[model samples]
Target: MRPLDPDDPRSVETAGRAYRVLARIGSGGMGVVYLGRSAGGRAVAIKMVHPEFAADPEFRDRFAREAGLARTVGGGFTAAVIDADPEAEIPWLVTEYLPSVSVRDAVHSSGPLAADAVWDLAAGIAEALVSIHGEGVVHRDLNPANVLLTADGPRVIDFGIARAIEASSVSRPGARAGAAGFMSPEQAAGDAVGTAGDVFSFGSTLVFAATGREPFGEGPWHVRMRRVQSEAPDLDGVEGDLRALIESCMERDPERRPTAAELAERLTGRAGASAEGAGAAGEGGMASLPPAVTAEIARRRTAAENPPVPRPRLEPPAPLAPLPSSPQPWPAGPGRYAPHSTMDPAQARRPRTPLIAAAAFVALLITIGIPGGLWFTVRDTGGGVEAAPSAGPTPTASAAPASPSPTGIRGELTFTIEGSGRVSSLTYMFNGKTTKLTKVRLPWEKTLQIPSWPPRIPWKLSYTCPPGGSSDSVAVDGNVIIRGQGSSGTNMRSEGVL
Candidate 1:
């Protein structure tokens, strides 16, 4: 991973700090997170306040307060804030980077986990919520992205949108668009949020994981809003303990939903009983048992292999071996004696001597011609060639008609210039060196074709427009360079010169 670009609006700069940024891990409304490493090689997730919010001093102060509150609720299911600098240019806070997949990605890629995994996820989230609520913080945004599925359990992330119940106001300008399908009715209505909102969001997330669908309507923002505010969440496909638990969490009345502690206990009890039943079943089936996961293998093999869908841990096998190197001679009659056929060293040396001498004579002549060859080349160019010795430089070879000699090449290039501007010529440059084009013509609107060219080299194309307007981009073979002027100006050009 490379360190996030400091100039990138999504990247946070903590220069002179002990840690070095590795790469951007994720971003949310409040800030972007970077996976970074300390001088001591410890992996940490660094979140810097979005510059838009950092401009507001009040938001920074609130972030600092919330960060302190977040630090207090460290436990099994929450990412604990390790360090923070709320006063930096891009106020950044660091946390532990638990190597895990987000709930959204897990469900989307693998479809969904089994019932056991879902139960574990629900219990972990409930326990984490209890700690968060105990510390006077309410996670206003608890969507699938914030819920991470790790080996230990699910861990909740992103508390920038969280509210402290003690504060008089938690809402900021457009605060957070708390996930559409997960927001509680109060949150959707822009009313005050309580612990129940977190529970509701968590339940909605679980429902999404179970069914691979949102609990509310999809499409435009207005439609989703209508569903969140008025429609009852459909828990039709939800089964097991999840059905009852989700129902309680998503109850319209906040008072009717169970507390975080209560939900955690219920889910934990279900998990324990399920584990006991699984173990008992295993014991009872011992007499008629098959190999571990053997039935699963048979079931999968019986189905069609969907090629378009990537199957991890699987690749086509290697090809067969080639034919033998040489043909074997037929066996002689009963091992009859034969004359010795091995060649003497002197005989082998005699044949190679003349060839070696001829090669030496040729090499000597080539060595002698080196200086003469250089002089001829310089003389042909009028001795105007200069050798500054740089990475790349434009060739000043004299223009000539296209020939099969491979000295220079010319071809038609269609330029698709997007912009409301007039293009003069498409100039080609090698590396950072500029090429002086002698002739130019527009083959099409925003397209240019040049003739009598030079040999193809690693190069890029730049476009020039009237009134000194220029387009930025360099492409190989100058096939597709878009050029244009104005904010929405786009131009596609093709140039062939080598």
Candidate 2:
């Protein structure tokens, strides 16, 4: 059926008395959206099935079944289904009137949303999908056009084409109930799809929200459909956490994609993060976006209004009482509170006597400098070197033969040389102590330096490589010294500065 212009009066009277048609809001393949009022004076968007579909009993039944399932999946993230008439001459469904622009309008008019807003949008849509999917229904037509941006949050709409998990494939011939650039690859291929298909669509919606570009690229509807299956999204321009997320969603393999709940959690992690790129282009010189686009939206809205109803007024209340004075102040934000007991005393006023005593006790032992605090100081000693507690540190010098060097370092720094490498004999001395390493590798073991010596004493290691080896050196300061043959014809040298 041809789209009836909203300017035409006949379109307003097409639906039955179930709703009082006000003005046409929009139109699509399944239905025309009209701003209407219920018998109780509640505003709603009455979606009447197109005349072509209304004439077919099979299509009408499927539309009604899908809408009914959508209503059962109640959630704040979705527009609430108010009423519907499956037996009417023109089947129509009414949903709570959402006085906000669809995501398509927001992007086309105000440009793409900021990173924070984009994440929030993704979260809201994902939450709605979670609810829809929980009811065993798949919103097979998720797209930017079906998402509305309101003051409260983004809302998912138009479940006229949703499919129940157990629903049969008895849809009408021309009823391809999804946006061209937003459909998943599986959906485009006419294969049985599951929740992952919705995830793919959600990813495409994010691509639109992030860069004002469709994930599957753009062209004629058919050409765009072909791209969804045959091409990948060019994510070079999109930034922030969304880049990886969109990549995961748009991956050719559906099994690897995250579920709606998983996507919601991921997006929640990214909310309020800083945005980059052309997404922040708002109105006004200081606005985060361009003004021309917002103005166009406002103008379109004004033209669409029937008689321009007055904005609602909310009255301010009386002044609030003054807060009480107290020594204790309120905790700020989440997980913040004052200590209230010995387990967690206020750090400022807590006594440190115990800590001081503990420190003094340990320091006194160190100062005495004996293997034990005092040898035979106890009054009940048997006269000789009565065995002190086993915990006492035994003087190893007395226990073993006294050698010139008490302790020596011994550890192999095995370097795994990559790409035709070898290690030659290396020798270095530091503070009169000699060390040697042999048969290292190219690009790894050209020089060795022991850095534990006294100040200003430089030690060197001589190793050989196949003529051309690494000859680069960087000064690094540390207590334990090390130097080695380095990369690609450069002197491998590093100084440890303690």
Best by lDDT: 2
What is the Cα-based TM-score of model 2? Answer: 0.52
Cα lDDT, model 2, residue 443: 41
Q: Residue by residue across 54-93, what tens digits does model 1's lDDT show?
A: 6667767777888887788766677877777778876778
Over 1-498, each residue of candidate 2 has an lDDT whose tens digit, in order, gives 111232222322324555566665655434457676666676777777555556666666777788778779776678888777777777778788766667776788778777667776777777788888888888787888788765456678875454421132222222244666788898766577788988898888888887888876754444565688898875767875678888888878889998888877776644432211112223101122245544544554454444233222323233223212222333543787844422334754667564455445434333343442332111122211122223454333232222222132221112112225444554444445567777655344222342221212333334444344433221111001121234444433322111
Q: Distance (Å) between predicted and true CA of 489, model 1? A: 30
Give stretches of model 2 more than 4 Å off: 1-17, 160-175, 272-498
Models 1 onward score TM values of 0.53, 0.52
Clashes of 1: 13
Residue ranges of candidate 1 with Cα displaced over 4 Å: 1-3, 6-17, 160-176, 272-498
How many clashes would you count in candidate 2?
31
